[model samples]
Target: MATDKPCKNLHRSPSPAQCMDHYGCIYENNHLITLLVDPENGRIADANRAACEFYGYSLRQFRQLLICDLAADPKSGVQEFVEKALPAGDEQSNRMFIDRHVLASGEPIDVEVHTGMMKMLGKNCVYTVIHDISERVSSEQRLRESEERYRDLVELCPEAILVYSGGIILFVNKQTERMFGNKKQELIGKRIEDFFNEVYFQSAEHNKLKTTGLLKERFRIEQRLIRRHDNRIFDLEISGVPVIYEEDKALQLVIRDITESKRELERAIRLQEHRHAVSFPLDSKAVLEKLYIPARTLSGDFFLFHKINEKQVIGIIGDVTGKGITAALNISALRVMFMDSLLSTQNPVQVLNDLNLKALQYLGEDYIAGCCFLFDFGTGLLKAAGAGINEFLYVPRGRDCERITVKGAPLGMFESSEFEEKSIPFESGDRFCFYSDGMELLFNSDELGRDYGYLIERFAGAALQDDCTWLGLNIQ
Candidate 1:
């Protein structure tokens, strides 16, 4: 895209002194830094204003210096440039190379040099154009370092990491070999389907479709796979993110073994079902109406009611910390403690205190939030105490529901925890509702439209979420 021009005409024989003045004007206004150099001795014959500004030298000073003096390694580079530019038959040919040049301030810079032969003052000379490429070189170095860091990070990760392109394995880390029971080389360039059995291939196909549909997005799934070395099937939790590999779309997968967690989940479900099997009497006199629903196979909520004597009945509703098997175990332990405490003492405050003291024996760092109540139909007196049960609804005869707020801490946290017993007068038509905290999840949904009329207005059109348990008793 560039053309060469000689000072005056090539056939003219102007004086060498006038050569600089005439040639200088020709290249002074050129955008590129331009210089005319004697190819035989490497001496600069003339320099344009742009070259003077670029080298931080005046025209008189720059013309005194040799072309080789500008290069970082002057002797070797200048020799090469002179040899390449002075070849006899290549008068119009251009030679290009990259070299380091020293700036006027002694700072070093990278530049691309374009050199071509020219005739000036009836003598052979070379014209050179220099372009600064320091930023470009620096950018390329940074990109190389960034790619190296990425590879190092992926290789050292604890979880199995893999990169796939076009549905084939393109890369795998050291952990992948350990996890899949194969060498890293064995996975490269192989199709992902080659690693799994037919049953697992079906699941992998489905997952592949999901991942492809979510290009440039992130997703996670749990599935079972058979280890190639041992034929052992285990659960794997795979997380994938779309990425660019060599400028093409690819998927990066991180896999973790979750077989133990899956087994624990199954065990928790069975324990939760068995522990919650303690049923309440459905008779009209004891518990009039009841509803219980667990959010998952394992519930962290429970409700229990037992007749203390002919005239009195005791009941408790509790929400335990956490979910799954651990929560179920704690709920079962708390149930036993609650039964023992109430049987020994009818005072609601004393019963709560006893359970709190015994909780440390069976529970770990977990706590129980609950309200306990005892009703005596003979004396028309009802006593209630709570430890961290925030919502308790009391409905008076032919009246709306009201919340009973008991300021107390959760059981099992502190040995010095205390509970205050609240007493209310009970009448024939007065009804009391006892429920676990999770019951609030369904308070606003159509699922509770049958029993809770006041909540129908409060939680209208809301979705059911957490576990729900409710017990209602009407004083006879």
Candidate 2:
């Protein structure tokens, strides 16, 4: 219920108290800056206390000023202010406008103005409510600038990037266009399946990854893609991370071309497998059984055996300090040196001494854990020297296995390194086992029983973290 009561003095502009009695305290006491203006001329008739404080103007000064004078741009602001204040179809309907207003101190501030036509003091007047939005505008501007910077970074990225949702490609970076040999217009709004090979894209593993990616899980997979211009299939490593695009859940995929690298890796694997291949010599009195397992495509472990005579065989089993192609190349160099050393000496200690000198000269900073041994079947004796790999298992027929350790420093470690040689006389039905340090994962103690075959089976099934090598000799 409202009452429109005429004030005592209606001829002059109303004071704050008089305006409050006419329009209620809401217009004068409201925190938001409120103003009353003549709709026809955009002349400010009255203003609240908040408006006076916000604009640095007293109520008397505000009454003398025009509403257009408060706008940053006064020329067009005059027409704009008057046009909003004038009554249209619905006079009570509020119209909102965002504009810049100048304060008394000459500082421009962004403001949201809500204007409506209303009857005040028996005349059609405009009621204006102003809300300062400078902070919100500043934040929005910073957000836009940040988005522009992120878009620039994405465009300059080296790897192909794509944003996809529901199997359809929503966005593609410049690198993606160059990699797929397609233009921006050609790739956008296309299905991701269209660019990928049909057989691989539809695979169960690939579908599983797609499902996982949609669930916001990060995933990586190797896929084959068909080039649109050439129709040539190429390998691609696609790493996907969940992202939001246009307010919808999507996936961003980083794709790398790995065709050349994959081919080079395959060639290296074949070469390493050939380098590790061993051919045993034919001997009736001695039986040699070995197991070699690599943790990767290339192994650090290497073994070489040369027959000195029908009665004697000399061998060396070594593990380099590192793995991969470098270790494989070191193993090849050591193999050639081992063969040359056999020509000079048949003694285990002298062979290691010669190899150590060569390793110091050629192997650079790398060290080797090695065990060299000479077995004589006719004399029934085994002589072995160790460098880093010091333990050996000796199992005699119908007796418990004995642990034999030959102490020596690792090769290429010191110039004055001394090696100890252990000579054990063997009888008929005795077994000697020599292994690299990786074999310690199976048996930590010195007592490793007679069954070498069972240990090999267990090693085959066990999860191995390093390269392992085992060589066994049986005297029959």
The C-alpha lDDT values of all candidates are 0.75, 0.80
TM-score, each model?
0.71, 0.72
Candidate 2 C-alpha lDDT tens digits along 276-371: 576555357667777776663345787888888888888888888765656767787888888988889989999889888988998889998899
Per-model tally of clashing residue pairs: 1, 0
Residue pairs of candidate 1 with colliding backbone atoms: 444-459
lDDT of 1 by residue, 260-292 (tens): 877877787666556456554434444455555
Measured on C-alpha atoms, candidate 2 has an lDDT of 0.80
Please list all clashing residue pairs in model 2, or write none if there are none: none
Return the TM-score for candidate 2, rounded to 2 decimals. 0.72
For model 2, the superposed segments whose C-alpha errors exceed 4 Å read 1-24, 52-61, 73-75, 82-90, 208-213, 280-476
Give the Cα RMSD of candidate 1.
7.3
Off by over 4 Å in 1: 1-26, 29-31, 35-75, 82-97, 114-126, 201-213, 281-299, 302-315, 323-368, 375-388, 392-435, 438-442, 449-476
